[model samples]
Every structure is written in structure tokens, then in C-alpha cells.
Target: MRILALALAGAVLGATSALANGDALVIGNSRYTAVQTLFGAQRVAQAASALNAKGFDVTLVQDADAADMRRAFGEFAELLDDDGGPVVILLTGAFVHSAGGSYLLPVTGNGRIDEAEVLMQGFPLDAALAILSAHQGRAFLVLGETGEDPDLSLYLNAGLGELDIPHGVTVIRGPAMDVARYAARDMARTGRFVRRAAIEYELQIEGYAPQGQVIVRAGDVAPPRGAIDPPLPDPFANRAADDVAWRLAQEADSAEGYQTYLDGFPGGVHVNAARQRLSALNAEPFYRERRAEEDLELDRNDRRAIQRALTILGHDTRGIDGVFGDGTRGAIRRWQEETGLRVSSYLDRDQIARLQAQSTRRAAELEEEEKRQQAERARQERVFWRRVEDRGEEAGFREYLQKYPEGRFADEARAVLKAIDAQRAEQAVGQDRRDWTKATQANSVAAYNAYLRDWPNGGFREEAKQRISQLQLDADRVRNSIEASREEKAMNLNFVARQLTERRLEQLGMKPGKVDGQFDENTRAALRRFQDARGLRVSGYLDEQTMVRLLAGGIIGIDR
Candidate 1:
């Protein structure tokens, strides 16, 4: 049991020595739920160290329950009374007195230390006395320091007054170690020694009760290991402007001692005094250099926690030793840069917060950008297909296919190009029919031959060949008829075209009197008769209207 967070009042000079211990028995019990348990193990460690230094073989047990503590005390009593230096049985825990017995608690004791059954569960002073009296060794009984019950001196007087021994049984109570009841009251005697001054000063400090190791110096052998004697020799007692800093840096052997002192007492209450002394002792350089080195072990763990947090934020701290070395500094700087802060090798609370904020923002931006790019790509695809469709030709389809061979509409574009080529082929066939019709109306072998030449494998190729065969036999005949018509024996025809018209009119019931390819009088007379019969003015010359009507009436065998 020890003071919580704060250090105890030091020895006036400092505890440098103690009475030599033979076989020391130290029992620390802190597991009581009914009362305050021991908060820290430092006191137990300190007591053990002091006794071990005095050449006593020390056995320490902590957090022990009732059975384990009883077993320990029984073992202490067994080895304690017989064959060693005077025994020091130091017990540190919760203490209570009821029915004239002092009870030192263990981990599992029911209710309060004052109850009779609870007293049975604890290690009592009477058991300690029985063992000391049984061994031949004069024993010193010690109640060690704890946070609760600093004014517990009456537990000793009440318990011992009921025992069989003389007042020679020396008892010690520690760091608070008060025995004012034995010295100043009815249990008073010239025999008991106590820390009157330190105890008085400790009582003045608020909140926590003061308790310390006690010593009994009545025996001529040596002083016992409790707080009855004056406090031990302290190296930093004279250096104490502040009570805690000396214990922390000088006494507790902690590196954080100086730094923690400076942080808390920066108003120059303790720091300025420490600095003045540092120069005189030439310890300034040592502290300056080892300040970080001597920090609490927890500080290193703290650094590792910070590094792990940074790692989660995507900054690599390289290692986690809790020290802010170059790698850690660089990580901090990088994080500061990413979060849009001034680049630096150090970090404070504000920088860490912003780093997290900026990381979140960057993630959101990247997601948004991805969505935008996807939409743009889709729009481009739409435009590409539309351009290809609006042209609606082979080239338009081919352009789309070349650009986007694996595009969404690639197969459809191929199908469209095939359809366009088929339609063009069908249109070319219709033009071939019109050319054949014009050749048939010319009614000459040359015209028929020309039609066959143009459409060698066309649908009208057979018809053109048959007409050419018929016209080739009349080449001489047509010339003779033309000669006759021009001599006025028959009307002259312009060519075979007029001759064919005369033949068609004659077949339709007009006497043209000639079947020659010339614009003769007979051909004109037949044309007028055909026009008159067909409800037109009998113009002697063939007219455009008459030709159209003749062609429409199938009199002219031109292709429809």
C-alpha cells in the first residue's frame, strides 16, 4: 500500500539505514472490498529493499487472500523465533480493532476488520507474539504503510494489552507510522519511538491519510524495520523546494521526474529552484541530456499508441517506441502536408484532428471524380453512334466500326451497311430496264446492239438481241423505202422511228401506204388519222402530245 499519485513526506535527513534484519517477513494484503485496497506496489517494494539491504532474507507476497496470508504468517512464525537475527515481521494492509484485538487484513475477509469473524480471518498480533515468545528471538512487529487508517496506533495497544508478554514487545507503524496513543496517552511510555514531526506535517496535507514504515529501536540489538525511529537519510532533502519533485527525480529514479515537475510547476515554484541547484551541483547538463531518456516508461508506450493511430491514417511512423524520432517526425510532417497544413516535423492536437478530416475529404473527392468520368464516357458513346447514324451510308457505318470495333452498336452497324448495299443493287437493276426501253423504241439494229452492249447480262438482254436480229434483215429495205418517200412517190420519214410509228398507226386502222423508216407523207397521214381517231387536232406533223398518247395507247411498243 502506498500514497496514490503523490509521494509521501520524506525522511528529515532521508532514510539511509535501518536496523539490521535477520530473516524479515513482509506481508502485504490489498484485496479487501469492504475497505480501501492498496493502490500501488511501490511501498511493498521499498520496504523489501530496505530490509534486504540490512542483510535480512526478505520474502514478499502481495494481493494475497485470507488462506495465503495465513499460510505466509505461519511460515514467518516458524522460521522467525529460532535461529537468526532478531526477526522483523512487517505487515502492510488495512487494520481494525474490536474486542481488544488488532486485525491486519487479507484479500478475503468478511465485513469490516472490527468484526470478530473478520478478525479471525486476518493475521492478529497475538499470533505474532506467540511465535516470537516461542523462539528465543526478540521480535519487532511492524504495521506497514497503507492509504487507509493512518491513525491506527490503538490497534497495537488494544491487541497487546490482552497478550501474555511484557511491554518489551516492540511495535512499529510506518510511513504515517503514528504511535501517539502509546507515547502521549494511556499506552504511553518512555519506550515507544514515533515520527512526531513528519506525522504532524503529513496530517496537514489534504485528502489522503499519511502512512509510512515504522521502526522499533528499544532493543540493544538494532532498530527494527518500521517508522518508530527518525526518518532515514535522504540525498535530496536539502534540495527540496517542492516535496514531490525530489521523490520523483532523485528518489524514485524516474526520468520523467524533472520533466513532469517542470510541466506541472512551470510558474517557477519548483522549476526555478531546481535550475538554480542544477548549476551548483553541475547536474544541469545531465538533466538536459537525459530529460527525454529518463521519462516514464509509460511515455514510451504513449508514443507507440500515437504511432499506431497515425498508421491508421495512412502515415507510416516506421516504428513505435513512443519516442518521436526522425521517422515519427517525418510521418507527422507528411500528414500535415496532405491535410493542407504548413509542413512541419512536429505535431500537436490540432494537426492530428485536421489530418483525419482531410483524409476523409480526399476519399469523397476521388469517388465523385470517378462517377463524373463514367458519365462523360457514356455521353461520348452516345455522340459517336449518332454521328454514324445521321450520315446513314456505308462510310458512316464504317467510320463507327473503325473507331469502336467493340462498341455497343458494332454488330448493328454491320447489319445496316449490308442492307444499304442490297438496296443500291436493286436501284441499279431499275435503271437498266429504262435503258433497254429507249433502245427498243429506236427500232434499229444499231440501237438494239447498243442496248445489248450496255446490259450484257441485264433482264432485257434477250429481248434486245431478238430485236437486233429482226432489224439487221431490214437495213437495205428501210433505205429503199426512205429513198422512195423522198422522191414523193410516198411521204418521206425522218428515220426508222417514224417508220415504226406509221406501221403502228396502219395496224390501228389508218392507211399509211408505207412501212419504211422515214417521215414520209403516208407516215404523216397515218399519224393524223391516228390523232383524229384518238380525239386530237389532226396536225400533219407528229406532235409531242400525240407521241405521248400513241406511246400510252400501246401503239408504240416502247418499254413501259
Candidate 2:
């Protein structure tokens, strides 16, 4: 167990402390009547001697009774008041666990260990833990043989296990479990390693076997990991952020030191006091600037503007009020540091002008950037317009304007629409001319009206309208004269037919409706009846075929 303990000791996770103020409370109670002698007194006395050799303030109690154990815990809690250091607890004895309560068996028992009387004389583990937890420090509880009691769930449930993170308490049953647990979280996170031979040599002094059945309940952050060799101290441990923060907060020195301290340990120990001193140191430069500015007739609002400007440049001036404070001075120094200017807290006239010039320069740069973007946009628009023009379609032109207005083909599309309209106008003019000439030749009122209606806006519309008006007035008289001419001709024909055609009609045994010579409506009807009887061409006029058929019928036809 001694060998295992030392082996585990070599790989302590938070082994940074010198433990200068560390107290070792080693208790060993072997003189028990109701239980087996656990030989715990010999083991823990050895552990106490080892701790004393390592410079720990050893508090040993061998074969302690119930009263003595209680007094030891009280002194332990008191000793922790002055120094917030590591507290090592070594317990080797018979432990009682019943009704979910844990206790350490005392040597001065009057009855059997199982009885309530003897149990009342034992020390409560929970009470000791409560007192220990009151102080702000690290605790390492090293337990001896368990016999059968597993009531160490008190420490297990307190987030104590193999994880290397800080905890209220850590339980180390033996050296193997302690070292193995440390090797897992630490080795997996950081790949630094230690030699196995060194660990074996360190732990061999305690006469422990190489047993490793360590159960770990390292909460949510722990991943399933294979075993790994223990590691040496981290190479960059001294320069770690926590270490630097701890150091800077502890020692507040120059103005820069305090500023650095605040940067590193904003919520660390003694940080509030460090910041207060830093604020005072920073005020020196701010006052100097204020007095100089006042003498130079500068308004206090200028400092406020400068603070705002510094804030824009990512420097934290804390606030933008006119009274420039330590925070503002520190921000000024930071701006100077970043800008490659001479590092100082005080701002002179030239320095303020240079700092203020950055804003002007940035504005000009942004304006130039915007103009460059506009030019690029126009260039892209031209390229897209050219591609759309290659398609040679109105739809492509319309779609292109949706993306890039006033495209290269926009003017050409207007020209195409104008050309189509002009060509259609010329074709309409030609069609109107042809229709008007046809109406003039026909000399009919209906044809002229049709031309006027179909081509209301046509090229010959005026002439068509005038001709239809004049032709309509004479149309009735012309129709009447034509009817008279047709009646006179029919009278002459009737006189001839009456002289020669009536007797032929009587011979054909067909009524010629009065046997009149004129081809009147009744005579025409009789001719149709006679033609039908003879299978001759039917006619209501004295056509050549009717004349031939009449002659063939042995009738004297009109020779004229």
C-alpha cells in the first residue's frame, strides 16, 4: 500500500502547491474489542512519518478514543483558518456503515461494535467533512482497508474521482487508483508523459502489489479513454494563463502591471484591490492631459470624443464621459501600442491629432471601396447585357433588364419595334389603294360603301367616301332606266310571238296563258310546261337553245 501510495503521489494532478501550510491528520485505531485488529495503527503511523519527512505539519493520533477523535477534527478545522493550503487526511481503522451513515470505530469501546451504545462513541465522517469543507482549500482523503464497508459514497458523490479538475475533495483508496485516475483525464487532455519505471520505483517503498481495479465516476465531461503512461510536469505550466493571473493579482506593482493583472484576472483573487490601485495610477496621465488641454483652451468634450473614437478602434476606454479616467488612459496606451507609436499614457496635442486622423483616413478608404464596388457592378452589368444580346430575342432583352437595367440591347429593341410598326403602316396603305380602285371601277353604291367601311383610316378613304355619296343618289334612277329598257324589248318580242308563236303553242296542246306574243310571266310559265313536255332546255328567256328546240318542234321561231 505504501508503494502504491507513493506511485500515485508522483502523478498528482494539482501538485502545484508547495504545501508549505499543508496539515497532515493521520488517525490509526487498531485497539478494538468487537472487531478484528485492522493493523491500521502501524500503516497510518508510517504514513504520518512519511508526510512529516515531506515537510507537512503532521498531527498523528494512534488508538484515539471517540472524544480524542472529535478534538482532532476541531483542531484540524482551526489550523486551516490561517493558511488556505492542502489538507491531507489519512484514516486507517474499522469503519462502520449502517442506515446510510458512515463512522470511524474508536479504540475505547465498552460493548460490541454493532450496538448503538458503542456506535454513539464513534466519529461521524459527515461531521468531519462538514467542518473541513467550511475552509477554502484542497483535500486528499487516503483510506485504509475497507473490510466490507463501501460507504465512501460521501466523497464519491461530491464530484471526486479520476478527473484532474479542482474539487472540494478527492478520494484515493490506494496508490494504484490515485495514479491511474490522474493519468486518464490529464494524459488525454495533454499528451505530456512520465516514465513507468519512475512510478514503480516511487511506489515500491510502501510494499503494495500492482493492483488496478479503480472505478471512476468522473462526471459528464469525461470520455471513454484507454490507459496511458503518467506524464511529467507540463512544459508551459509556469506560463499558463491561470498561473500568470495568480501572480499578477497577488503582486500589484507598476501601472502596466496592474493593467496586465486586470487583463488576466478580471474575476480572480484580490482583483478588486488590484484594479483600485491601477485606477489611481492611471489617473496621473489623465489629469496631466486635462490641465494641459485646459491651458490650451480646449473643450472638455474633445476628450469624450477621443474616448468614443478609441472605443471604435476596439480600445476599451471603459466609458465615454468627458472626464478622462484611468480606463481612458490605459486605452490610449493600448492604441499607441497597436499603432506602432511611442508607448505612453499621456496624450500630447500631436498625438491626439494623429489619433483623430485615423477616423478621417478610414472614412476616405471606405468611400474609395464603395466607388470600386459600383464600378465592378457596372462592368458586370455590361457583360450580362452582351450575353443577352447574343440570344437576339425580345424575351431575352426583357429578362436582361430585370437584372441589369439600360442594357446594351435596350436601344436596339426600341428600334426593332419602330421598324415593325412602319412596315405594317406601309402595307396597310397599299391595301387601301387597291380596294378603292376596285370600288371605283365597279361604280356600285354597295362596293363603295364596303371600301369606306373596311378602310376607314386607309390612304383612299376620302375618295371612297365622296364616290359612295355621289353614286348613291344616281343609283335608283339608273336602276329604273334599265328596267324600262328591258320592258320595251319585251314588248317588241311579244308582238312577234303573238303573230307566230301562239298557234304553235296550241298545236303542242299547252296553254300559253292567253297565247300572247309577249314572253310575259304567264307565257314564260307556259313555255316551261311545253319545254318539259318535249324534254327541251327549260328557259324563261328566248335563248339560242330554246330557239333551236322551238324550231325543231315545227314552230316558226323569231329569226331575229
TM-score of each prediction: 0.28, 0.26
Q: Candidate 1: worst 10 consecutive residues by lDDT?
A: 1-10
Q: Best by TM-score, which number?
A: 1
lDDT score, candidate 1: 0.48
Off by over 4 Å in 1: 1-21, 34-39, 109-119, 134-137, 144-165, 174-560
Clashes of each: 36, 12
- Expressed as tens digits, the lDDT of each residue in 477-516 for candidate 2 is 3564365445324322324445456667666655666655
Candidate 2 TM-score, true structure as reference: 0.26
Error of 1 at 136 (Å): 7.3
For every candidate structure, what is the RMSD over all alpha carbons to the true structure, in angstroms? 46.3, 48.6
Residue 72 CA displacement from its true place in model 1, Å: 0.8
